[model samples]
Target: MNGPRERGRPGGADAADRALDDAVALANGPATARPGSRQPSTDPLVVALGHEPAGAGPAQARTRARQRPDAVAWPEARRLARRVGRRLDPRALPLGEDLLGMALARSLTALTDLPSFDSSAMDGWAVAGSGPWRLKGQVLAGQQRSADALLGGHAVRIATGAVLPPGTTAVLRSEHGSTQLRTDGEWLHVLASHSAPRAGQEIRRKGQECRGGEELLPAGAVVTPAVLGLAAAAGYDELTVTMRPRVEILVLGDELLDQGPPRAGRVRDALGPMLPSWLRGLGAEVTSVRRLVDDAGTLHAAVAASTADLVVTTGGTASGPVDHVHPVLAQLGATLLVDGVAVRPGHPMLLAQLPAGGLLAGLPGNPLAAVSGVLTLVDPVLRTLAGRPAPAPYAAPLTANVPGHPVDTRLVPVVFDDESAARPLHFTGPAMLRGLAAADGMAVIPPGGARAGQETAVLDTGALAPAWGSGA
Candidate 1:
């Protein structure tokens, strides 16, 4: 069942030579320019990613603006991400964690007939005809069906769930029938008060539920726990399930520590530890989590070498000196599919297609901003590739005022109120995660912001906390 992804090459690792060429282009790509409008940062990455930096002067900004693609709207960016993944072929994966949460690639068929044998459904007497009959044999659950066929006026003492003997027409339940030993091979009689057993009474006939090879569930059915149980009963040891999108997370920044508390200006790595599980929950198979410094060449090599369906890089998506995502993409001849998004906190987030193969999502440095990028880009792509159904659109009224960016949409982490209104949480700045940790979902506030009692679309975060979470 294991085969290379037929999207062509079993994609992981591109040739180093191509990566080197890309690196060379990165080294000499942007011309050295004096700081124009904003003081600290330059215009290379931002301009290339279609963002007008806060510091660029009129002439320089105008010059750079003409060479850039406009940042995509919040909704459009997500749509682009989904579009890129539509071509990925689903796989016939064997059942396991790999299959968990993935849609079935094909219909699940019954491997064997349901109740493959004629059996007793309860503790009863298997009879050939009306009783007041001779007891000929005995049968218990799991015992072989009687080799001798039953004759008229004869019965077998059968336990619950026992396979009924051939030629048996009906079952007389033990409680409704009485036995006597007047010799002549011990007789069985139906209690007149209970009446005689009817035809096929208490005898579970084979294939009554479903016959062999019948389709039990249609293709596109999700492999839930109940499905697994049903599959086991239908003679399946493994399930043929849809492939999960493979993702590789690259945590960028030299000022990030792999462990220990923040020290010497370096902060503890948050995305590295969290993205793997988060991506898994979103239906992507996180293949690897690599920690790298903010070096263009390292990022370039890593991106080029990855065979994952999607490569996610945290930090270094802006126009800072350390920002290398844009430069690397330019060198690699990659198409900036969703060059940048107009959402707050993650306005610099980008989605790109590597020429070698696969896609990359560039998330902003701040934890919360990175999360926004995931929702805007990574989540949509994975869903399409994994064949997961998109959640139904939903909205909730706001319990309090939610501030918004004038021209950009805001994704505010919120808890539900007593009336099921979405209550915006505090500490929801781009760099913070505290508010998100306490949130049930993110309320999508339009450009003008949302007022109390105003209904706004809410994106499900999958963590539906209890009513206690509804409190401020």
Candidate 2:
């Protein structure tokens, strides 16, 4: 099932390179100064293409902004991911440590047998042969092993997890015994109505649980509670784990206020409060958050001061009068990783990395659009940093007819029938948080796709798994 990203190369990365080169050329041109302003011509590409960066229409300026330059891999955004990932090693980190405590990323591998000792599966009498036997002393969990153990004509009481003393072959539960226990003067006697047990009956043989040196877990596994429990049982006290990627957030918008009521066209801050929780879910510790105005100078300073592995800026990514994010980013010599994805609702998504070692994800202004960018960009980066294995796709048939998209790949909210097999329940727009709340996951529809009771790939919330988990 392993394969490359199905959608192919990003168009935004390519677009950003061309735009940067053109902007650079314009910066070296004669019209390098802004009218009635002290700002160095930030968007030279717009000037050269016959437009003003401040008052230019988005369509025209964006068109002029495109000066195709040779594509360079490792755009600024990916470099951020790499920087964050550099602190952690996926393979050396133990699942136990990651799930149980705060873990720094390091390379790790399993070291011990999962189940160390051979034990019995049932509570019964232990006997060596098929012949009859007398009742011996009982052995329960935590009791010391018995010496001079004889099973030829005697049965010893054994409980689950209790070491089977030498000469024990079979375990017959008390329920199967005609007379389980009869108290005598100093010992509890058992009367066997049947012959002694045979080999391997109710007996967990040595190395059957696990060899002493066998591998209990693989590298790059994100530690969960059960994973930790397994490692602990395997006698591991410390585990190496991928260090959590550090993240930084910058909410850009003149209309947004960190606190206080909206005045006129302004709105309450949407990004600052929401980003921390989302980053945590992706296993990242958000180190800082900054809010910047729509001014190019302010935006440039914020980008320059950013110190996290990944810096996410909201608003000003698309073409707008106040949009100075792309221009400021170009000026910083940040490589464009992905300027736009071919997906609906999050097409304006921007990805880049500064030369100084950090990643940047530019999200659209709409709350829904920003959420899409987090899932599409941030989630995968965190996964890569943690060294977790790529997850297999979850498949479910569409509950209702889903509309097709001719131009862009679609991420549709879906609910599942957690009571049985996971079944898909499609919902409305990316903007509809209520609709997403009712969903168990996001279903991916390929570009130019249609569906009617057809199966689709789902990015499940993982809550759909049965409490015991799928046996697979």
Candidate 3:
């Protein structure tokens, strides 16, 4: 398993040095002018990435200086996430119809030939001759009927799925044939209007779909409804699927209420109620959601005792007085894989590998920021662990201009307009959820922001649902 640690730091010293150079260059150089324009834009990410003009502003300069040198770029952070996911071993689960949406741990093979036996594919007469014939008894599905071999002019009534009798030649449809009451008494006959019956026309032969021991589905295929039906038909009562990753959430905040309206200085525990459902949608089995105090001891104990594969902590990622996540992680001898990200509304999010073999993702307390952290880190990691592939890249033109962060990428909520362009939504601050709730996805805005009509990457929130394939 090529784990993130074993892979060495992504974009090592030279990359870091280059990032530093870019940062310094942004601080010292003048902003580059847009094509055909004399003035330069003041996008924060652009400024942070060394596109800011010299003497842009004192505040911008100070902000650049204060930026953490170790902050990871958005793309690199995701690459590391994939590495972490690939390192973990996948557990095999017993198969059942309920295992739909789970990934197959191994290829599925047929235990028996499909259709299993030759059977009638329609309700008709199993005839032995080419024309008018003597009628035998009727044979329904699942019935065992024994009769003398049909002579050249004899036939028997048969229903769909009924096994063909001995000496059966071909099936003639009831509508295509008729009963004649003649001097020879009652007789079953083929109609004159119809042409000669084609042999094997309505017979479903054994192994029509698949033969015994044939490969039915490959490993990593998602167990969908069709797959389940196929598995049952192919003689499987159980299937081996990749186990869902176990997750334990720690919602940290002393000013959060579990079941009440906001009052005084406290607010509702938004993350506690939100994380579990979203995590489950991402193919994680949330083992627990524990609310802990802002104290370092409580967090340290929880982190040390967790048995889940991933430990997600909300809030306390910053260096403020109440921020204990960093200190607790440090005390536990955890390796900080990502200290901070170059993204808006979730810049304080962090990732670490614990000494106890569990991974920890520290998300900022703000509602939208926490969501950003989930997409940036948790989403990819769980998908990899579940044996799912990464989602394909998607982009759309912007319907309006979105303000950018000087040095960080921005994930802004947007709704699709009539033109299919993504229009940025309002009330999209780090602490707000209104915009997100009404949004189709979050548009990826680069530094210096994007002008109207510019193409931008979009991350669909609906991709988190299990029905959405590998993104789930």
> Which candidate tops TM-score?
3
Location of the lowest summed lDDT over 10 successive residues in candidate 3? 1-10
The C-alpha local distance difference test score for the whole of candidate 2 amounts to 0.57
The order of the candidates by TM-score, greatest first, is: 3, 1, 2
lDDT of 3 by residue, 1-472 (tens): 1100000111332343233223322222223343443224544323333233333344443454477576777665766775775534544454465576677777899998988988889999888867778786878899865555677878888999998887788899988999876786667876789876788878889899889999998776778778888887787778887877889999999999988799999999999988888887777778999999989999999999998889999999998999999999989999999888878889899999999788999999999999999988887678677775543334567788787877777889888776667889999899999999888778877656777876555676643466324342
User: The CA-based lDDT of model 1 is what?
Assistant: 0.72
- Give the poorly placed runs of model 1, Cα more than 4 Å off: 1-69, 86-98, 116-136, 141-161, 164-214, 416-421, 451-455, 462-472
lDDT tens digits, residue span 1-472, model 2: 2211121111342343234233222112221233553323544334323333222123322332352122111122333333343445433443443343233243234354434455667887776665445676778877765534655656777888777777877777666664333454222223455443457778776667566665555554455667667666666666666566677887888788667886887788866887676666566767888787779998888789877777878888887899887899899999876777545566678778787877788888777677767766665566555454434334455666555454344667766664222233444554455666666666665434434554445554332333212211
Q: What would the TM-score be for candidate 1 when compared with the true structure?
A: 0.70
lDDT of each: 0.72, 0.57, 0.74
Q: Candidate 2: lDDT of 92?
A: 44
| Model 2 spans with C-alpha error above 4 angstroms | 1-114, 130-132, 140-146, 178-198, 257-264, 417-427, 461-472
Which is the leading candidate under lDDT? Answer: 3
- The positional error of residue 295 in candidate 2, measured at the CA in angstroms, is 3.9
lDDT of 1 by residue, 1-472 (tens): 1111111111111222122112111111122234553333232223222223222234432333354447666665776787787635756555454455667777899888988888888897899987688998798887754547899989988888788888899999889988989846698988889988889889889998799999998765667667777887888878766677788999999998877889887788888887787887776778899999888999999998999989999999899999999999999899988877767778899999889778999999899999999888887787667765544444566788776765566889888766666788999899899999988787777655657866555677643322111100
TM-score of each: 0.70, 0.69, 0.77
